[model samples]
Target: MTRAMGRLLDDAAEGGRITPDEALLLYTDAPLHALGQAADVVRRRRYPDNIATYIIDRNINYTNVCVTACKFCAFYRAPGHKEGWTHSDEEILRRCGEAVELGATQIMLQGGHSPELGIEWYERIFAAIKASYPQLTLHSLGASEVVHIGRTSNLDHATVIARLHAAGLDSFAGAGAEILVERPRTAIAPLKEKGEVWLDVMATAHGLGVESTATFMMGTGETNAERIEHLRMIRDVQDRTGGFRSFIPWTYQPENNHLKGRTQATSLEYLRMVAVARLFFDNVNHLQGSWLTTGKDIGQLTLHYGADDLGSVMLEENVVSSAGARHRSNRTELIELIRGAGRIPAQRDTLYRHLAVHRDPAEDPVDDRVHSHVSSTALNLVPVAAAG
Candidate 1:
């Protein structure tokens, strides 16, 4: 690394923010460990507690029937594909019961952009879940889905979000934001909404007092400049409204996907993204490492590379898992992963409040039943009859 670059990272580590150009340079020119060290230093300064956190949550993919056929995704089936199925209310409630039984504090309903499933469909499902599990956080939906709902229901983005919020939508999950830059976004998810639309929807939601995280899907043949551009887009929006709770960067799962695994982000690339995102997103609070996609070792390594959160135990993750994410962990293993990274493990809620800190390994909770991808009917793709 050049002395200038070293000084730049030093400034960032010492709490000085860097511009987008400087971040891109640091992300490109800096050595892996150099960036990791500087990023970890910044992380340590912010989180002096030396605690790396993980959440015990479930991603309940409400449906897999989508219209926008993003080439990189293997999970979405067309509107009327026989394999496409929507879970019945009883089935969804049963999964919620399982998540609660296994101690999941957050439940994310990751549905598809089915034209049939409009605003009323979402409201009914969310209301039913909230009615049954008022204590569980309804951290479901994303900006792209919000846009789809508005189009389907002929309502504005704000109206769609407000109604969903009233129906027990706790927070927006930053899904479907593969690469916010137009070039990569268009190349990868052409049918989805544009990057500006995603940003505007999130900004609107923030105005309405709803917050969300920002996720960037990496390794879809995007150039380094485009990657930095993606972060810049998010950071600009975040500066206006501090609605994004965290920034998560995960690699695309290439297997069983339409993109054909022709382009993939290596583990080193993923780590660089984690470090760069932490340094760049000074306004954002948390940075999450994608354990489910990059595997447990890289996930653990990310704790030292500027990631304060190891993402969720992911009691069930169908969308990514179907594409190639195979990593699974229960509460016990997740705590171990955090502790292995030389930090105390804390089970956090959706808002990132510490629910339980496993300071003592001897006292760690043992719950093996909370396996990820555990028995979701969609997990095996043997779709049940679609919900009416």
Candidate 2:
């Protein structure tokens, strides 16, 4: 690391705030541990209690039929493919019921941009879910989905979000933001919402008091400068509205996708981005490590670096799994992983509120059924009692 970069890292670590250029330089030049150490300092300052949070949520991909067939996604099918499917309201409600039974506080209702589905489709589903599980947070969709739904329904994105929020949608999942830069986004997911449009929709949501998270899917042949630019764009918007609750940067899964494992971000690269995000997104409150896409070990290591959240104890996750993310964990193992990393584990709601904290291992809640990769929709066919 250069002397100048070292000083920049120190400044960022000490809460002095580094510019985007400084962050890019630190990401490229600083030693891994040093960068992580600086980020850890910032994290400890932000979350003084040394607690890492995880959410118990089920990602309900309501449909696989999509109009915006992004090249990087293996989860979405064509609009009329035989494999295409959309979950009925009854099916979705059942999944939500199962998730609630297993202690889930959030439901991430994601799907493709089917031309057949309009704003009314989402509004109906959101209303039904809200009426059924009033306590469960309906945190689903992203800017891209909003654009598709609005265009399909001939409504504006703002109206789409407002009606959904009125019907029960709490916030967005920050999915579909493969990269905020234009060139890479055009290359990989040209059919999806543009980078600026994504930010604009999120900004409008924030204006309406609906907070959402921001995300980055790295390793798609983007320049280091572009990565920093992505952060800069999010930071600029956040400076104006303060809507983004957290920033999650995850690696791109190359398997089973059009990218075909041609290019990918290394584990070291992932951690470097994590540290850099911690340094750059100073205004964003929480930084989550994607253990589901990356390995569990790297996820734990992120806690040491700068991440205060380990993402979800995903009661059910299928999109990344469809694209070849195999790592899975339940509540029991997740608590152990957090404790093993020398931090207290707490179950958080969609709003980042501490729903339950496992400070004492002896007092940890025992629910083996809270395991990941277990289908939230299949709990009925295989009873939890019998399955456990």
Model 2: per-residue Cα lDDT over 1-388, one tens digit each = 7787778888999888788888888888899999999999999999999899998889898987887777777777787687678988899999999999998899999987888898888889999999899999988998888899889999998898899899999998888788989999999887777899999999999999899999999998999999999999999999999999999999988766787878899999999999999998889999999898889999999998899999888888777777777787888878888999999999998889998999889999998889896683323221111000
For candidate 1, report its TM-score: 0.97
Worst 10 residues of 1 by lDDT: 379-388
Using TM-score, give the best candidate's number.
1
Residue 333 lDDT (model 2)? 79
Model 2 ranges with Cα > 4 A deviation: 376-388
Which model scores highest in lDDT? Answer: 1
The C-alpha RMSD of each candidate to the native structure, in angstroms, is 2.6, 4.7
| Whole-model Cα lDDT of every candidate shown, in order | 0.88, 0.87
lDDT of 1 by residue, 1-388 (tens): 7788878888988888889898888888898899999999989999999999988889898888889888887778887797788888899999999888888899999888998888999999999999999999998999999999999999999999999999999999998788999988999888899999999999999999999999999999999999999999999999999999999999998766667789999999899989988898899999999888999999999999999998887888887777777677776787888898899999899999999988888898886786677765435554222222
